[model samples]
Target: MSLGLAGVCLALVTAAGATSGSVVFVPVLSFTLAWTHSIEKVRWEEDYVVRPGKTPGAAPVLEAVAARVRGSGAGMEPPPDARLRHGWYEYTPTLRHPAELRLTRSGFTADYDWCTGGRCRSMAGLLPSNGGVTVLTACRSAPP
Candidate 1:
């Protein structure tokens, strides 16, 4: 699936199969996901890149390039090869393609943050509040 300039469409759907929100990023590209650990209270971020699939009719490829965690301890341990720079422990994380992010709305912690094109916004603010599980996935954007 060669997207070319078609870009990618990200959909946020609730567990009950209702579409909450969606966004289209032109020219298939990269984005960052940030969130605070519930127990550790440390901020973590993952950088992901989206590209055309290897075959026709295939889903878009998703790859996480790097991850950064601020103040590691407890559930926030950085990898051994992680470098400490600017108060952040940075390292590349191993991930499988076609990643589907399942976000839980527990209302007990901060919502996940999505950043793209120099802007950042919480998932709660981006989508409708349903107090349920929300699945975030990438698909081919409709041609205009």
Candidate 2:
């Protein structure tokens, strides 16, 4: 079974360099990644778009990452183009195509939240507690 919704698909690669069989997400075309800075303790959110690959059965592409930071402090500097809106600095940072967003689950700070289709779920709830790195990438289908 797949966990993805109706757009793209994703899987979790643990810190041990092994892909977890039960970890998956049937994501939508757009998703928001939210996490807290390890040191700053400030919240940050990034919106991403998953575009289908040109070739059949090929991995999809991830692009258009618009990010926002709650407050700027240590390691939380917003870009010059960032605009303050509702107490958050919103800006669209440049990102290379096929972006691979790697998030570290240190089991110390708050767990990252992946939001889509007006719903939010913690990464910890979607995957096992490995306390390692979880790579979120675009895929055409859920891994077997």
Candidate 3:
């Protein structure tokens, strides 16, 4: 019963993120639910390649964003079983200021451009060298 309710919540969240066209990061359980719900996770992390003319390297930008997400502590823990199953997801953001970047579990990547102060420019692609990476908590039931 609880699992069912959790599944429903997970579906709603994943749908919301997908339809909104923004990257969303969720804990492992919610990610698993997204898959069960048929919402594909984008792999922006691995698929992104630095285009010849692109400003910043794709790898560095992704690493920076991943670091930022990790540091932000957003969706760090898997929700209780009563809330959802275990898995994690990454997607692009939906803002115009900072380009939306997405990464799925399968290594898909999506990039969007944005405008700033009247000038069109890609938002800071990654965290500055000073920004630290977020530490994700391990799955409780997983083997260490």
Give Cα-based local distance difference scores for all models: 0.72, 0.74, 0.21
Candidate 3 residue runs with Cα over 4 Å from true position: 1-47, 54-86, 94-144
Pitting candidate 1 against candidate 2, the one with the higher TM-score is 2
* lDDT of model 1, residue 3: 39
RMSD of each: 3.4, 3.7, 21.5
For 7-82, candidate 3 gives per-residue lDDT tens digits of 1011111323433222222222211111111133321111121112134322111111111111113334322321
Name the best candidate (by TM-score): 2
Off by over 4 Å in 2: 1-23, 55-58, 142-144
- Model 2, position 9, has a per-residue lDDT of 42
Model 1 segments more than 4 A misplaced: 1-28, 96-98
Residue 91's lDDT within candidate 3 is 40
Clashing pairs in 1: 1-55
What TM-score fits each model? 0.77, 0.79, 0.15
Q: For model 2, how does the per-residue alpha-carbon lDDT over 1-144 read when each residue is reduced to its tens digit?
A: 443333544456655787776646555688888988888889998888888676755567888678899999965689899999999999987774645777778878888887887788886766655677777777644434
Residue 126, candidate 1: C-alpha displacement in angstroms:
2.4
Error of 2 at 79 (Å): 1.3
